[model samples]
Target: MSGKPKLHYFNGRGRMEPIRWLLAAAGVEFEESYLEKKEDLTKLQKDGSLLFQQVPMVEIDGMKLVQTRAIANYIATKIDMYVEGMFDLNELLMMYVIQPADKKEEYFANMMDKAENRYFPAFEKVLKDHGKDFLVGNQLSRADVQLLEVILMAEEYNPSILAKFPLLQSFKARISNIPTIKKFLQPGSQRKPRTTEEDVARAMKIFRS
Candidate 1:
């Protein structure tokens, strides 16, 4: 891309949020065009901006990209296996976030069980076995960013979730302190807040309209 990539999505975090995390981790500054109303999305469709009539689209490198995975893959160029696993964890978290209030308790319990037992342990072992600051290599990669994002998300659900996994606790501390990511973590950065019930209602109105 000649200029900074321009992202199209709602104001709140959704599938696009991870793309923001990845770009920030890579130290890239980008622009966003939030769809504040249904007409905003309709106009994009009318103009053929969306190939599949979806948001979370990006304008970059003389191309319009859609599909969350495709956008992340293009940004990452080559995704590590560990990065893919971390994305799976992110999806599980997103599912819980968007669940109906009545269903959230059961969903949260199940998600936490899988995260603590299945997901967190696997990445903890990766960090421990490698004995490095990053998961896949000596340097940072999408895997590291993805892991950090998920760790924060998991912690938002349970502040003490990482207590059992000391290595992951250290990993979170280490990756989050990186200068680029650290900047993104600061207030007034492009990073979005945790999804709220109002966000879900707003999104429902936008898409259903």
Candidate 2:
């Protein structure tokens, strides 16, 4: 909060959406350094800025941070949106959805299957057990926003993914109605989630240089 924080990420919502949502929810002012070209990220990697050679690196509080979860957690902590025992609960809950024996493609297929058959049911139960207002507590937490992103991503792949989970569907609608989230949802200046083969080739060239 001392100075303007700079968020460097691919021009996509993949891992950066949660971080962006937390920032917007907190009303924090920050700058985005979009690495639209993968080679730009490769340049950072060569220049020693991208320690892990990954997108969504955050520069804040005079320090550079790596990893999506770490970046999101840091922002949530700063904004007081992080509730103990609430964040990352979905990850833990979905741990068994993808088995260790499955290959990448099989793991992804199983993940989609389990999301519908197993995860949504569990989430619906949790929603009923708790309240429909929020996932963690009475107030909205970063975890809820993260869940929203996950649901949206799933829905994008399969429009009817949430048709069975009434409670979860309701929950998605509830969060989407938030003023800040509503504004964020507007198809305006946000970058689309994509990367071209040429971008990948450029990244490889930089890597081999």
Candidate 3:
């Protein structure tokens, strides 16, 4: 993996999952360093030289990149994974879901409201109108994976949340089926998903008010 770029993320699935799958699907080797606990966090802070205050940072030949979307886009661009207008369309999709009630504090307060029935239809509509096989054409792209992350997160609140969207399910299956991605699905490569669920619950407890 030293020969290729490296990606740093907490052991939980979180936002990094889709981007990691994107790089793997490209058949490109990358360093998938899983961080957990206070020490792991401190060590990453020490050695990571973070370009952004985010996990899923990619270091290509020692250059660091941050932001889940940016990381996805960078890998997508390197492998030409983006579709026509998909780049912009995907951004629009993200904004539609997050729907910052307060642009200044969007990331902090936005997710609390998402547990309701507000945005799922928007996503389903986009996936349905765009077709099920992918968000764009036949090949998988960053948009597909990002949507997968959203779907997975939504599952925390309701497993049936995305059941209506067959294409999105197909897209999730497609990424999970990849050889490299499949490997990460095994129990040991990363932290157990149940732990991530716990983290989500703890975060939501604060927003539950």
Top candidate by lDDT? 1
Best by TM-score: 1
- The lDDT of each candidate is 0.89, 0.66, 0.57
- Model 3, 1-209: lDDT tens digits are 34788767655455665666676666776667766555554565677566544466778755688877666666774333333233333333334333435562554244434533445555556667866566656777666655565555556545675566666566677777767667766676542353344565453443233
Q: Give one digit per residue, the lDDT tens place, for model 2 in 76-173.
A: 64333323222343343233323354454565666678668765676677788986587766888776777776677666556898888888888999
RMSD of 3: 7.5
TM-scores, one per candidate = 0.95, 0.73, 0.58
Model 2 clash pairs are none
Instruction: Sort the predicted structures by TM-score, highest score first.
Output: 1, 2, 3
TM match of model 1 to true structure: 0.95
Across residues 1-209, which tens digit of lDDT does each residue of candidate 1 receive? 47899999999888999899999999889999988889989999999999999888999999999998899999985656787788888889887867887999999999999899999999989888999988876998888888899999988999999989999988888888999999999999999999887898888777885
Considering lDDT, where higher is better, how would the candidates rank from best to worst?
1, 2, 3
Model 1 clashing residue pairs (backbone): none
How many pairs collide in each candidate, listed in order? 0, 0, 0
True-structure RMSD, every candidate: 1.3, 5.5, 7.5
Residue pairs with backbone atoms closer than 3 Å in model 3 (clashes): none
